[model samples]
Target chain A: MFVRLSAALLAMAVLATAGSANAQSLTGSGKLLLTGGVSQIEGAAGGGLTPWAVIGGYGSARQIGANVYATDVNTTDFDIRSTGVLIGLYDRVELSYSRQAFNTQDVGTALGLGQNYTINQDTLGIKVKVLGDAVLDQDRWWPQVSVGAQFKKNDKAALVTALGARRGKDTDYYISATKLYLARGILLNGTLRSTRANQYGILGFGGMDDKRHTQFEGSAAWLINRKLAIGAEVRTKPDNLAIAKEGAAFDVFAAYAASKNISLTIAYADLGHVVTRRQTGLYASLQVGF
Target chain B: MTFIALALLLAAAPVPGQPGAATTPVIATDGKLFAEFGGREGLVKIVDDMFVNVDADPRINTFFEPAKREQTKARLVEQFCVVLGGGCTYTGKDMKAAHKNLGIQKADFNALVENLQKAMDKNGVPFSAQNKLLAALAPQHRDVVEKPAY
Candidate 1:
């Protein structure tokens, strides 16, 4: 149960970050509000946070922005680090890419996957706003929506497959909705995602199904002021490798919008053990755009 | 529910130190403007003249083409009222952000501003008051325009 909860939490954190990164801008709908900032969440949809229904960071048609970011995830057996770039176009559409490097530790020798094997994964993604500005139309019935996709390729797929994986490459699709109640300074966001990757390959893939997995994700943010935002998310994912149980995990985060071009995000994550204990860590991201 | 009631009360409360009460400025200013424009009956006449000027402007017509002109005119009245210190909230984008992405050229902006000036003149807004409002909006040009606006 702990492992399952931790996995769920990890997924939730990623999604939350993606949403913040993308929707940080006030342009809730249309192609005129993209920004160049990293989200507080990592590995979700936008540069840092989970996908938001809005098109870009808080900027509307009046500005342009972009971001470059890096992240490191430390585990007992291995450490994973990633670096990426995000670009916003006309405050309407976004393009992003990241490369992740996983370094195996003593656990690699014990498991025989390889002695200190290095695994690299590259991901590319795009997000487009579909409807409504949550900020401008706070009293309306419409919710802001966006559609996005990510393509990921694992560089050490041969080794991963040989270790018992069904597929080496995968793609994910997501539809996200974001709404901001400006009067109350509250923002709500949700995402429905479909993916084929197994457990983010923490325990390796191929134990169960290789088919696409359908997931539900949601988050809420309270804008305390123009600069500070506090939020949380709960995300559902598949426990394919028999490592963790299937369920939802929670993520709490804080973000600071330093300016139109820069922002910073930080979070504390708890990833429960698949077999025995829970794993918790600190996460941080910085995004800058022009 | 209580919040709604409070909002309504606040909206209706009289403004202080004018032809009416002395506690609320919104009501007083609204009354002043209403009287200056010849009261509720004259408001209709002024709206008609304003619409005539808006209809003659091609640059702003794109935003008006899809709508019922009468309805648009009503919203504009509310907007103008709110902007001119009538105490009504104007639920619209800040001028800079709204026009920034439209790639609105200087000619278009000048034409629209001129048309609005004409409407205000037609509505009999004092020249000083019109110039004050235009001055307040002038700084917005930096954000609303991305290219040389000439």
Candidate 2:
């Protein structure tokens, strides 16, 4: 599945660039550097793990921009690899898709499962900016707000059901507000999500029960310079999994926009209570955009 | 534990070889301080550079073309002088009155601001100094923007 998706994304990127004569000329001339956040875990334009209010890519108003990213997170007992593509339209709408493969390394054998068992999930997301511009409204009290939805489907449906999961597919809806304090060189984002997914659908959708709860995710970043940005994110989770206690997640990341076309991000993630115990790991991602 | 410590240390670490003592550039938030930096000459340079940028920016260039360039620049200088407490009273129209019918959108205002930033940069105004002036000018968005915030 990863191979197939990667092929499709690559093909689209080639096509978008090869036939780039018409709409490829982005003329809006957007704001300062690092204002457009990095891609999120689920392929949304945002922090590493959570979504922010800004759209993806460098395309300014009335322009189209595309981004491609591949991310890997290696933990004590697990390895998660995700790849995705995002498109930003007119700096108002965003569409993204990502495939995640959760490789339970030795932990699978320890849990009586086969060694290196993998759980895969596919996510499709769309977000629309409803109001405010984080960069333009720096002096005001208003913050940019956006609404988005993510549709996810897990591949290990039978195993997910056997583990007391609710279903194989579900959708999570969220509203986010992001603010960029240009003068202070700080960016803040807050989001409220209504979801039923367990372990972001890698462990399958929902938990033992049928109820969904609202979760909070927030991120803060400081633009140290035109090329460097450092941020921390915390995303709370719902405790629906009867199998294990699901705790909130935290990550501290540094992103370097090496150029307008490429950016690299490195982070230390503390994802609490996955499978059984805590998993702390290093995360690295590379994103290419036009 | 180690991650938190490392992040804190990175956050606290001084930015490598940049202007000002802090990671970001220094700015004079007050008129007296701004005067000490360069006063009228600095403001004039900033204004001149900003107009050059505005002239080049297609996003907001049309809005500026119909008006007399010199008169507008003079008014801006006067306004900036007063803003920085140069003791020059601005005799031009107030912000709301001056921009009432212009119907400036958030994007336009932001473009104008972007040009202003470039101008400040060209004149060697510290990032902090540019931000200070912008902070003082930010409130005028209420008068300049014809459209609602977005």
TM-score of each: 0.57, 0.79
Worst 10 residues of 1 chain B by lDDT: B16-25
lDDT of 2 by residue, A1-290 (tens): 45765676666556655755664444343544566788899999999999998998776665567778899999878999989988887788988999899999888898877899899899999999866667765444667778899999999998887887879999998888898776677889988888888888887777767877788899999877668889999999887878777889999999999876889999999988888689999999999876
Model 2 chain A: ten consecutive residues of lowest lDDT: A23-32
Query: Which candidate number has the best TM-score?
Result: 2
Off by over 4 Å in 1: A1-37, A40-49, A57-59, A62-64, A75-78, A113-117, A201-207, A243-249, A274-277, B1-150
Candidate 2 residue A263 C-alpha distance from true site, Å: 2.5
Model 2's alpha-carbon lDDT is 0.78
What range of 10 consecutive residues in model 2 chain B has the weakest lDDT sum? B16-25
Position A162, candidate 2: lDDT: 81
